[model samples]
Target: QADVLARATTWRDRLGADTPRVAIATDIEQAATLELLAGVMLAGGSVVAERPAPTTARWQRWAAERVTTVVGDPDVARGAPDAVTVLDLDGSTSPRQV
Candidate 1:
């Protein structure tokens, strides 16, 4: 899990220290979900789990929870507003903007 933590640390840094909550919106089977959640907690941040659902519902939950950083599916991340940062865990080369 060190590798996961390391990656998560990198992501957390990008998210910034003031970020209070990290949202997870990926399938449970995805290893990155657990790793990112653990990493965020270790960094003294809270976590909000977003159920796998429609893009609108997921984004709504994120907005309602005031999610600072999102770590999971890129598709859902696309729906996040410009205020939220998205860390895509699908191993894609291109990064998701807002």
Candidate 2:
């Protein structure tokens, strides 16, 4: 517990006061997916743990949540507009920018 707290404090200090918002929105909870979400958060961002269904209500909720990035299966954000950024988890070195 002490070590964990120490590391958390160290990271907070390293990231500084103004942590940029990465907004990692995803439904899948695989190791890579979780890693991405955690990475973004640790780097001063957010994680929206939800799946994409392309429904009006879901869209509104996403908008309200200010989700800027979707990371998961391609079908997750299949019909998303070009304005919305999507990252594919296709076993690549990094998230595939789409």
Candidate 3:
């Protein structure tokens, strides 16, 4: 867990901002979400785990939460504003490359 948190710190730092709000949208079968959630939280960041097809209300909630980043499916990532960084975690266990 500590190791995962360390990696999360790296990801948080890599974001290059004081952003502490991250939104996760992915399938339940994926284990990467666990790592991502832990990492973000360990870095003192908040997380919003959303399903792939989120409703307008949910999206509004995300906006209200001040989501600074979206880490998961590409389509869901597109839901974020242009200023928000979208980290695609598709076809991989780690989020290093994308």
Candidate 4:
């Protein structure tokens, strides 16, 4: 609970009321995702996620349900307008943005 409190305080300080709805799309499993999710919520944001899917449609549904802001691999940071922010944790390279 201490960790949660600290994270929430930090989030309130950084974001104020501009809490973001986030989604993480990656191969990362649920257990591994909790820490990150907690961080987001603590910051007054929300998170939606699922295992990497074979189709974008599936991911799209999840994004819609959670109102995600970003979607990408698990190693790098990617930005999205509607979600909290995406991070790729596997250290993989993303395609060119253009």
Candidate 5:
């Protein structure tokens, strides 16, 4: 847990993101996923775990959250605002465990 937190802090610092609102589609039950979520929270950021289909409702919800970053496949962030940071971690490092 401590290690995860440290890594999170490092990543957050490197990204220069303060209190970011991150959009992600991941299962919260997984150890790695939970660790990442914890890190985001600990860094004073927020997470959107579900990726609703691109629609008026989705845009409205995302607008309400003021999401700053979307992390996932390229297609997942296709229509996000230009102000939002899109990180295509698809097929990237998949840490199976914490």
Candidate 6:
């Protein structure tokens, strides 16, 4: 949707100017994921893919990187760094008419 893209652009400007490093966790094919990835790239931040089946060790590794922001399901990010801010994008309804 144009509106969503516009909003994403604004977010990109607000967050991208500094080129902060960001971590993304979601299916790359999903629309929201694509939008977020684009935003992160536009913001000049490195996008690291979070493993769906992340282990404690993996989370620790991510935490060690000091990722300041994360965009993904809150439930999946529970064990990540407490200082990391998470943006949840699970409220969108499915487009399937059925």
What TM-score does prediction 3 earn?
Answer: 0.64
Arranged by TM-score, best first: 1, 6, 5, 3, 2, 4
**Native-to-model Cα distance after best TM-score fit, residue 54 in candidate 3, in Å:** 6.9
The candidate, 4 or 6, that scores higher on lDDT is: 6
- The TM-scores, one per candidate, come to 0.65, 0.52, 0.64, 0.43, 0.64, 0.65
Please report, in order, the local distance difference test score of every candidate based on alpha carbons.
Answer: 0.67, 0.50, 0.63, 0.49, 0.60, 0.61
Per-residue lDDT of 61-82 in model 2, one digit per residue for the tens? 6777766556555554544555
**Residue lDDT tens for model 5, 1-98:** 57878766664653345888877754455555555566567668888656556666654678788887765544545556667766533314222211
Model 4: per-residue Cα lDDT at residue 26: 52
Q: Tell how far residue 48 is off in model 3, in angstroms.
A: 1.2
Top candidate when judged by lDDT against the true structure: 1
Point out the worst 10-residue segment of candidate 2 by lDDT.
89-98
Measured by C-alpha RMSD in angstroms, how accurate is candidate 6?
A: 7.0
**Superior candidate under TM-score, 1 versus 2:** 1
Off-target runs (Cα >4 Å) in candidate 2 are 1-29, 51-56, 90-98
Per-residue alpha-carbon lDDT of model 1 for 2-96, expressed as tens digits? Answer: 78778777655655678568776567687666666666766678888766566557767778888877766656667778767766665232356
lDDT at position 80, candidate 5: 61
Model 2 per-residue lDDT at 30: 58
- Where in model 5 is the C-alpha error above 4 Å? 14-17, 27-30, 51-57, 89-98
Clashing pairs in 2: none
Error of 1 at 79 (Å): 3.4
RMSD (Cα, Å) of model 1: 3.7
**Model 6 lDDT at residue 44:** 76
